[model samples]
Target: TDIPHFSTTDWTWAKGALQTVDRPYGPLLNLLHHGIGSTHVCHHINPRIPHYNAWYASALLKNNFPDLVRYDSTPIHKALWRIATRCTVVSQRGGIDGYFYQPKPSI
Candidate 1:
């Protein structure tokens, strides 16, 4: 299934949402910022938080750490295209644990 991309800055929410709602042929990816996707921010902060209560937990975090928590409103299809075209290389930086995508330099 094709997944929606939110932003180039951070794709944690998008990835998690895709994993959670992904289905055969096509996914129900339109349910953005809801269900597992909405609670993704909270999940990263506290893995122990259950999915049922993630939305509430996320709201709290959003109020406290506005800078740290990012919610990209970009449509998934656009973000996916941007990522696919720009994020061409996957390599580690600083150390093995620090992996990232690097765009190909313009000719």
Candidate 2:
């Protein structure tokens, strides 16, 4: 994996959380989803944090690590269309580390 090495354990944990989780929806839906869908970043970073406390943890992560915390605001419907139309989700990165949906080249 071409995963970049971190200089400190804190950064390693934060970056790892960012890469592993995604906040797919806004706060309103987050409550409906029990934060698992919206505050997923914090959950992965510290699974010990309860769902109710996760929202706060997620806010802290976003405020402290704005660059690292990425919340995809794309409408779910549109995102689905994009996935169905052209992009076959390419999850395997051949030893690379990071989360992204890449399109496979059309055959």
Candidate 3:
């Protein structure tokens, strides 16, 4: 994942692509949460956009980078539990320069 020629913006986009998950929880719930829960990837891509405009930006990002944007529909509680239980460890691949979350080992 380490590309030596990538600029800081490119690196940020790459990180956001890997880590940001915009979880849609209905319009009413999204409104209640001020769009943070649903338009999180937009937030990561550009933190300056006001919450009111994040939806539009998120849609734009989704449209332009369909392969890169991660729209996770998993319930918040379940995702939290999964992360808590299985995402604790980070390890670097042998001879690699970066660290990544280790996949959970099968029993």
Candidate 4:
């Protein structure tokens, strides 16, 4: 429904990957890291030590969580991943519409 939100960390990671030269998923990685990495597009920064690392943690949670990971095979995940990574899953963005939208990152 929205442009898709992401944390600053997500934005940075995607940005870093995009900026890297000779990286396999250059275009797609950049898209995910910067394209959708936003407060509106992703979880808000943690009140304490809020930064890119926070979003990186978010990625880890989404990947390890069983229920969340299950969505990887679902159509929504399929479509989003395809669009973001261009069919290449070099990195993972965790959660769905509301999962980490207001993320309060753990220490």
Scored by lDDT, the top model is 3
**Candidate 1 local lDDT, residue 25:** 20
In model 3, the runs with Cα more than 4 Å from the true position are: 1-18, 26-29, 94-97, 103-107
List the candidate 4 regions with Cα displacement exceeding 4 Å: 1-51, 69-107
Off by over 4 Å in 1: 1-34, 90-100
Q: Which is superior by TM-score, 3 or 4?
A: 3
Ranking, lDDT, top scorer first: 3, 2, 1, 4
* lDDT of model 2 at position 86: 66
lDDT of 3 by residue, 44-85 (tens): 778899999998998998899887777777877777777778
Q: lDDT tens digits, residues 1-107, model 2?
A: 12233334335665766564453666677667786877777888889999989878889988998876666666555656766886656454555454346667778
Give the lDDT of residue 35 in candidate 4: 23
* 2 or 3, greater by lDDT: 3
Positional deviation of 20 in candidate 2, in angstroms? 3.6
Clashes of each: 2, 1, 0, 9
Clashing pairs in 2: 1-95
TM-score of each: 0.53, 0.59, 0.68, 0.22
Model 2 clash tally, residue pairs: 1
For candidate 2, the per-residue lDDT at 56 reads 89
Task: Please list the residue runs of candidate 2 whose C-alpha ends up more than 4 Å from where it truly belongs after superposition.
Answer: 1-16, 24-29, 89-101, 104-107
lDDT of 1 by residue, 7-69 (tens): 445456535432322111213642443455545556666678876677678788779867556
lDDT of 4 at 32: 66
Model 4: per-residue Cα lDDT over 11-67, one tens digit each: 554433322111122346545654233211123323242445544654664566423
